[model samples]
Target: MDKIHLTFSQKIIVNVFRQVRIIKGNLVHQKYFFILKHEMQLSEFKYMIHDLGPYSYDLSGDVEYLLQNDILQKYDGQISVGNNILDKVDDIDLEEDEIEKKIAHISSFIQQLFDRTLVSEKNIELAGSILILLWDQEIYVKSEIWEKIKKWKPGFFSLIEFDSVWDILYHKKLISKEVYIPNNYIERLKCLNSGSKNAREYYRLIEKFFRYIFKNELNNFVLKEYWCDGNKKIDFSAENVAKKGIFKKMSKYSSSPINTIPILCKNQDRELFGSDLVESYELLNYEFSNIAFLTIRSFEHDQWILDEMTRFYRENDKKSIKKILFLLQDIDLIDMVEFRLRGIEPSGILKEKLRSVITNRNVVPCS
Candidate 1:
């Protein structure tokens, strides 16, 4: 007979099957292995067999290979040692202790293989850090977390597939869902009571007030929320008003300047904005060309709240400072008192600083 050549992954799968057989004393459902694979972390697996090699292999692929080769049989959605391996299993002569030792040796070898297959240490660190955050929050929604993670480590994460990390963490049981209620009735009531009678109308009033106060300093300003292609909405946006014939006159010199600014606001019921807001910015940056400035504003009294939130994020998350600082720069703070006193005048100095920040970071402005 030709010698059966088992890959490192295949060998690990075979050992898992043997252990399951000893424990269950019957055929195991394929879903059992699937769930096991999803919830088992590489580190835990290493500890399981006293070996560090499991991380080097793709355990999922091994399961499929076993099923395909009939080394492990699947019937009625269940799996068991196949006829090909039944005789070998029956022929085993080793004592229980000896069998366990052999299994541990195999596991260590597999870990070695896994270590060889790893990406850079930095990539692993970032991936692990993000996973830990997701785990802590019990967040499983891929797109939701991916948007935030990308903002923090855009260059590194852009190259990774979110699903892959999700699968590994899921299999290891490192991340699981908990019942989450974003807002309770009391919280909702508070938001409703404190909220403006009509958010849209209130925004319109603010816009009118700013335009009236800064009539001399500002040419034109429109404030409204915009919904982009993905049905994603920008909380607040402002655009510069151009004098009649200004664009026509400037057409000869240059294209119309991108003057649209997206503002991230912190107010009651604003908790939903985190990931969704980031997603909107990403989409707008990629799809629109007229975005020139990004504004993050809150009431002056809420500065303490922002500071506390910043501290919480910095303590709980890795590289959060760089990400937050980049998004909400020192200049982006529009003190409610200051805005109320002076109105929204176009600040040439601030605009120049914003331009430099955007240019140096290679951030494509959004519409």
Candidate 2:
């Protein structure tokens, strides 16, 4: 007879059942086996599954196959080890000790996969810190976790960042998914032992890991803004404007310029501007010589809109005297200021000038 070929899912289900039976030393409830199978599907094999709105798995089908093949026996709403499985267990290669060791090796590999999916270096640092804190404390209360993080590094993280790190750790099995302690306490303890080390050394090792992984373009890499749309009008709403200004350096180095309008308010009549607008104006003033403001309101109005024109002069100023002389005629300080103020009140000519200057200076070579 040909040897039975088990699919990946079938193998996982069989292993889950085998482990349960070995640990329990007797028959196991069908519900308990199903629960373990479902958990493995969601956590270890989630990426392999297809979505049908809700996640689906073939645990039941695999179980039926196992029963038909005499690998498992069903009786009185419970599952038990069958003669075939017992004989297989007695096989030297499939002994209980060997199966456990294989399971542990596979689990470690799955954990590495989970760690690779972390979104950013900032997240990795925070996750590592929280893991260490949990190791030292050994408490899993939600409130206690937050308190510990704050006490360790005040204002270093926001609530959203904390929640994100916690979620990642839970999914990776470094922390228990259950909200309270004593739930998966044994597993949590094991995580602490595995991850616990000298704090500074751990951080140093993580930095080296990232450096190795991103070594390809570490010297000449430029930040790219993939989310930016060239044709989309720049949102001057308070939040959008503030974000743009805060990340202005990132936008400046991008391969393309972000399209922008002067200012937009939720209520057109209110004419409100956020502090970010003022900060952007100050930073632009510090960077450009010809860009001067007569008043704070003028800065808020639209004086900084001519930054593209000023940036061109700043770049040319560093070149030869001949180049400076040739660019002098093109650098219109008075006209640029006038155009900026006019743009605030909505003029077609000023808008055209703004668009032309912005497009021409959209991307400048890094110095």
Residue 88 of model 1 has an lDDT of: 37
Which has the greatest TM-score?
Answer: 2
Compose the digit string of candidate 1's lDDT tens values, residues 71-119.
Answer: 8876656565677574433332233565456555544433332244323
Q: Candidate 2's residue-wise lDDT over 49-82, tens digit each?
A: 1111112234555667778888777776656556
RMSD (Å) per prediction: 20.9, 19.1
* TM-score, per-candidate, Cα-based: 0.26, 0.29
After superposing candidate 1, which stretches have Cα over 4 Å from the reference? 1-5, 20-70, 83-86, 89-173, 176-367
Highest lDDT among the candidates is held by which one?
A: 1
State the C-alpha lDDT per candidate: 0.39, 0.38
